[model samples]
Target: MRFSRGAAMVALALMCLPGLSMAADIDGGSLSWAWGIPFAGILLSIALMPLLTPSFWHHHFGKVAAAWTLAFFLPFAAVFGPAVAGSSLVHAMLAEYIPFIILLVALYTVAGGIFIRGNLHGSPAVNVAILAIGTALASFMGTTGASMLMIRPLIRANDNRAHKAHVVVFFIFLVSNAGGSLTPLGDPPLFLGFLKGVDFFWTVRHIFPETLFLVGSLLGIFYLLDRWYYAKEGVLPVDPTPDTRGIGFDGAVNFWLLAAVVGLVLFSGFWKTPLGITIFGTEVGLPGLVRDAGLVAVTFISLRLTPASVHTDNQFSWGPMQEVAKLFAGIFLTIIPVIAMLKAGAAGPFGAIVSAVTRPDGEPDPAMYFWATGALSSFLDNAPTYLVFFNTAGGDPATLMTTLAPTLAAISAGAVFMGANSYIGNAPNMMVKAVAEERGVAMPSFFGYMAWSGAVLIPLFVIMTFIWFR
Candidate 1:
């Protein structure tokens, strides 16, 4: 009778539960706000140390990131036993960082292989046309893909010009940042949002007008500036690369590979398979595992298929991608507690932050969401910054898509658009900057770049605030 009663109790408990264990989740309320200091320190190191001591930071950057990781982890492990820390580490690696790096590597390798041969003269019309093309491609191939593909051609176009720096700056504006505003494929933050259940076309539907306005305004400004410089410098009597064989691409096959990348991402988003495995309390969905594996295969296929000559011509190297990987490794790790606190909402230490962006009447304020998300995204990694605010705005994709649509739009726009505010604002910004500087463009210093963004981009964002956010 006792055995029968025990079996019945077990059956009752089983009936009360879902079919499987819920995915591992962090308890933000259990965290201290002080846990964020190392994350902030890593961020500050990323922002300042490079500007302050370029060579030292460049060589020691990996070690610097490691130090910050230890700073966060040692204390974190001490406070919360190794099991909790291990779960957190496993969750960050499997669920977030690995996929993030895989996608970047696949895009970079694929895009790097595709080279546009033949020299392009950086005429105003030609430059504007390229910018327009890149902006359109960005929403599909990703800002990094579009940027890596285009930045070389762009730099080559202006190589003969006396006034070359501004061209690179505008390239950063449109190709590296604003162009990516229309879809999840265009930007990392949006992609992360998509993985979290935001629909594929949600961004294109909501943020299209804002992207058009900003991108259009930037193009117009660049054209006028380029035209004035063209007139001032006039044409050179002897063209540097005077070969008249119009533009032709070197690696045509990679375009299909790029398309496959897009398909895989969309497949993961749409295909729901009940099959998946739990790894360290994290659910590894079947589609995601397949997508990531497919991407790895695509990367190898591109590397093997494309001629080495194309890479040489493109001046392709792995340095920028390496830098992003090392730096973001530390970023993704340190920001764990910060993201946890944010997810805790009003009950957590960061409740005041959530309270700041909400109206007294309990409605979400779009303008505040825009500024708060944008401001942090400008300094922190935009992808995770987007996640933080996305949670703060109520982490429900269906609700965010419909009734709270404006809030979602604000978060998306802020994360994608304001990434140009600083070099460290987005991964591609630093890559573009490093590439431009190496190509002999006298890039603006950190604060110096801010002056340019403040002068050109800030007013436009303000106008956008009034037009869209209001």
Candidate 2:
């Protein structure tokens, strides 16, 4: 569904509200911890509902999200008055959710249009090559995009194999999660950091080593595992969907659009201007406006220019995007009070969280931040989880990128990397599983996937904590 125009109209309507501009700020220290319950409720809904009641969640996920949003807002208005609630909603929408969703839609739409044609034999070497390529592309096109683009071809390549579930599992590990650690464009958590005024290159520059360690280790492990499987199971006598043509790309025009997407994101980060407008309590910068508008143009342009056949081959639909949009809309709203409480620091209700991540010298502990952010991100939405720790670490981007750089790196690396710890850790983890299952891969169950991650990924994270986060 189209969101840009609707988002703009909502922003415009909110801007016109009479008293919202003068609303007082949320008093996080004064508000009890109960304000965070709606946020917890929504996150729990996201984590459990799908696994426990797939059919009901599939049909009514949006309604569930909306219910949580109201669960927060109605009580919030009753307690704090409508003006405060209105301004909070406006700020969350204009400053955070709208910009976030726009970039995702642009990437999703453009990337969906470009399909990789032809197939290769799923030899261990060939499988490693595909995973390597996907890992590299994930930093640019996003994990979701790279996962979608590469999964089908990889599946086709391995369809002739007797035992191949491990292949998809490693695919989730390398392509869908760890590969996206290096850039804001790569994953939702890093993007939220960028939106919070972290530089576009901050993550890549800071966490490249961690990303290399994780991705390289996972790839190496997968290669050895795949080789053993190939030796044991051997290939089917007849290849399913045998290679008919040399591997090449279709809908190449989207490459230009993808480049445009990158350019827009970078331009917004680099271009600073005093020019901006105030909508309710939020400041909408001119460069941000231009960047978001450019993304929307690129999205529709890809849809228009790419051949319909290309989209058909890709099995592209807006269902996933719609689901992300609705769920995150609730998340961004419910997270407002939570962020405020976090910003309150050691004196706030969440003082224990601060104490947990802080050293005796009053310095933030990188190791604690790493595991704390990681442990929560394993089950909650990584994007908001990142935001939670971000504000917890004082919510000052300048300080975060400088003296506290290691702590920032820890948080970033944790949210992105530990997302592979569970199927629901990142959105793309489940998407990859669903696609693989549809293609006849006997994918692991939810707990089964966790078993894989616990075995493979947890050990690596432990080693990383000692090597880097310490």
Candidate 3:
């Protein structure tokens, strides 16, 4: 029995495992050969993060944790490759993740520098008000739009305040992430669910209970924190001292421009819908139009319409967004090979994982998928991470509830709501950070932001687990 000690021991342990499936068997072909490369890549990037941003690493252990995760998963790409995968991983990364991340940075930089004009005294209350409004708006305007509109004011309100890192951290949890749970328009993952034939209104209905729970709980917490901070600092509420220069609604043009962009978004989603499209010499659809329109709108805002004075008032600059854009762009390129591998190995490589578990109701279990997909969404491109889960959830009888509708509801809620675990989880989060920095509220770095989530948000999610999922 000990003839081949270590190797044999490993083989025995693996085979004896419960629910072990054929997916674990590596054929040693192209797919098997390609496995594990992504894990290495992730590890390398994580290791390099601290080296590159030592000061950031100093207080942000959470960033270091994420870096380690990146390191660990990078190799999984090699284990996961082309022959076993389905969609082109490059398309997922580029078409899904990169553009949105870039857009967030650009919007944040522009708004942060130009529009933020409030003082820091009343910022906490304003931030709470913003989160409340944002949660409601998420259902209508989309979390991205609402976050973009509110983040600048939040930053401006807190501009004169120090020791407010917790404020922005909690802001991400409430307004950016948890708030978008109720509707397809609120989050991309839910939107993808809508495109996949799930009833759009179903998610909105089922998630209402969960949304109310989170909102009520978070707002209470935020108020206590806000009051405490205000009292400790002797901060007074600030009023927006009116500018008597009497420019009649001309400055409000930005609002109109912003609205125009929203209209374009709605039209693109409606017209070139995932239902498919064929246009002059090419077939383009939801993805195509969205990418095109989003870029066009952002470009117009960044390059053409934003007046010099607005930037001056908001303290806007291009650097933050550019940095985020560059980083995520690289991420988009690097993750393609990995995702491709995962899909390629779907049947055999991850078969065991895919098939091992079942829900309490004896349906196909989606918890693993939810957690893995969610973990990635928190750090990488949330949209693609979202799609990956949505795509994975497709066609699985086990993932559904007793009825088709409940199953879809579950998937949509998980994808949209949980995506807010990290700054990168939602586009608005990073923008909020850039805006905060522009207004001089020193926010926690990438990982530092997570500590706040781990402590506050994770527990809240546990309550949700029992209340909703259970």
After superposition on all C-alphas, the RMSD of every candidate to the true structure, in Å, is 8.5, 3.2, 10.7
lDDT of each: 0.84, 0.85, 0.55
Candidate 1 residue 393 Cα shift, in angstroms, is 2.7
Please say which candidate is ahead in TM-score: 1 or 2.
Answer: 1
Clash count of each predicted structure:
0, 0, 37
Please report the TM-score between candidate 1 and the true structure: 0.90
lDDT (Cα, 0-100) at 185 in candidate 2: 84
TM-scores, all models, native as reference = 0.90, 0.88, 0.72
The better-scoring model by lDDT among 2 and 3 is 2
Kindly report which residue pairs in candidate 2 clash with one another. Answer: none
lDDT of 1 by residue, 221-274 (tens): 999999999999976676666565878998889999999999998888878788
- In model 2, where do residues sit more than 4 Å from their true spots? 1-18, 161-165, 188-202, 228-242, 379-402, 430-448
